[model samples]
Target: MTSPLDSRQILRRQLRQARKNLSNHAQLIAAQTLVARVDHYLSGQQTDKLKKVALYLANDGEISPHLLCEYFWQQSIATYLPVIQGKQLGFARYTADSMWQENSYGIKEPVTADYAPSRDLDLVFLPLVGFDSQGGRLGMGGGFYDRTFANKRPDASPQLIGLAHECQQVKSLPVESWDVPLQAIITPQQSILVS
Candidate 1:
C-alpha cells in the first residue's frame, strides 16, 4: 500500500497534468465556480460582517478573481492586494479604478502611494499552487505569503483563505513550521473551512 506522502506525490503530478490539460474555457468555468463558492461563504453569517477583504490578481493557470473583485468593490467593501517587498508582501488597498504597476514578477500591484500601513483587514484571499484538506498550502516555491503571515501579531492575524481550483487539491502537502495554515480553502467543488 502506498503511504500518504507517496499518494500525495502521485496526486500532485496528476494535478499538474490536469492543470496543463485545462482549456481556456474550462478554466474560466472553473474560476466562476470557485468564485460562486467563495461568494456563498462570504454571504454566510460568519463572514457577512467582514468589510475589508484582500484578493489576488490571477495569472497563468490560476483561477481569475477579477469578477470577484468587481463585485466586492461594487458592494463598497474595502479591497486590498499584496505588494511584494523583498521576500515579504505588504497589503495595499485596491479598487477597480486603482492605478497598478507591474511588479518584478509581472503581477499587477497597487501603486506604492496607495499603501496604508494602518489599515486592518478582515480577510485575505490567498493564491495557492496546491492545497490539501488539512489547510496545508503549496505556494509558488516562494515563501513570501508564509513569511508575511508569520510576521503578523497573534492578535492581528487576519482570516487567511486560499483560492484554488478543485484540481489543485491534493491528499496532503509538505509543510514547514513557519507555514501558516489557511482558515478556509475555496475550490470549484466546495469550500473547506478549517478551525
Candidate 2:
C-alpha cells in the first residue's frame, strides 16, 4: 500500500535515474540543443538588458546550465547560482572566478557573503526532474524553490523558466497547492511558454 507521498517519491526516483542514465554523448548534444532553444526564444527579445537572472548548478542527473551561463556572460546578463540557505534557497553572484563549495546535498554553490533576494531577480532558470506543457514542474521534493519564490505576485519581477531535457517531458504532473508554475519550459526539443 503506497501513499501519495510515497508514489511521488517513487516517480521522482525513476525520473532521476532515467536522466542519470543518459550517455555522455547524449547529454552533451542535449545541452547544446538546449542553449539553441533558449537563444531562439531570446533572439528578438532584449534579454541582454535583464539585470539579474538566477540559475542553478546541475545535480542528481539534472541537465547542465553551463552553456547558458556562457551565453549570459557574452550578453552581459549577471548570472546567479542558488545556494541552500537555512531552510530555503539564496542566490549568490556567479562568475567564472566565483568561489565555490558544496552544500550538504553535495551540490556546488558559489560561496559568498552577499546574495540577491529572489525578488531582485528579473528571471530564474529552474532545473526540473519532470514537467508538462501547462507549466507544471516536478522538483527534487525539497520544496526549496517553492518556498523561496512563494511570495511572487501575479505580476512579479522574476519570471521562472524551467530547463529540462526533452526526455523529461511527461503527459502531466500532479500539481500541489504550493508548486510554483513556470513562465516557460525550455528543452532540447522545444520551448513551451505558458499563456
Candidate 3:
C-alpha cells in the first residue's frame, strides 16, 4: 500500500518530468507569457510599496523567471535570489553585474555576503513541483522554503507566490503540516489568488 508520503514523492517525479518535456520554444513562450500575467496582477496592487522581491533561478524544468526578472528591472524594483543558509534560505540582491556561485544544487546564487532576511522582502516567488487551488504547494522536497517561511502568517509582509507552468497544477495536492500556503499562484495562462 502506498502511503500519502510515497504518493507525494511519486507525484513530484511525474510533475517534474511533465514540465521537463516542454519544448524549448514552449518554455520560452511560457516565460514570456508569465511576465504579462504577473504584470496584470501588479497593476491592481500598490506598486510603489513593493521594493524588494525574491525570485529563483530556474532549474530542473521549473518555469523560468529570467524574463520576469528583466521586467522588474525595468520597473526599478530590486530583484533578489535565494541563497541556501544552513537549513533555510536567505535573500541576496541580484543585479545585472552580480557575481555568481553555484549552490550544492548546482543552481547559481549571487556571490555576496550581504543577505536580507526573508521577512524584509516585499514579495517572494517560490518554485514548486505541484500546487492545488487551495494554496497548497509541493516543493522540491528540500523543505527550504517551508522552513524559511514557517512563521509567516497568511497576511504577512512578504507575500508568498508560487510560479509554475499551467501543466503543473493538480486538482488536489496532499498537504503536509509544514507546507506553507501561497497567497497566489501564477501560470502562463492565468493566476489563482488563494483566499
Q: Model 2 off-target regions past 4 Å?
A: none
Off by more than 4 A, model 3 = none
Each prediction's number of clashing residue pairs: 0, 0, 0
Question: Tens digit of lDDT per residue, candidate 2, span 1-195?
Answer: 998778778888888888999988888888888889988987767775688888888787788888888988888888999988887889999999899898898888998776888899988999999988888888889999899888887478788899988778888888899987788899988889984
Best by lDDT: 3
Per-model TM-score, in order, reads 0.84, 0.95, 0.98
Descending-lDDT candidate ranking: 3, 2, 1
Spell out the clash pairs found in candidate 3: none
TM-score of 2: 0.95
Distance from true location, Cα of 158 in model 3, Å:
0.3
2 or 3, greater by TM-score: 3
Candidate 1 residue 160 Cα shift, in angstroms, is 0.4
All candidates' lDDT scores? 0.77, 0.86, 0.91
lDDT of 1 at 9: 63
Candidate 1 overall Cα lDDT vs. reference? Answer: 0.77
- In the predicted model 1, the residue pairs found to clash are none
Q: By lDDT, is 1 or 3 better?
A: 3
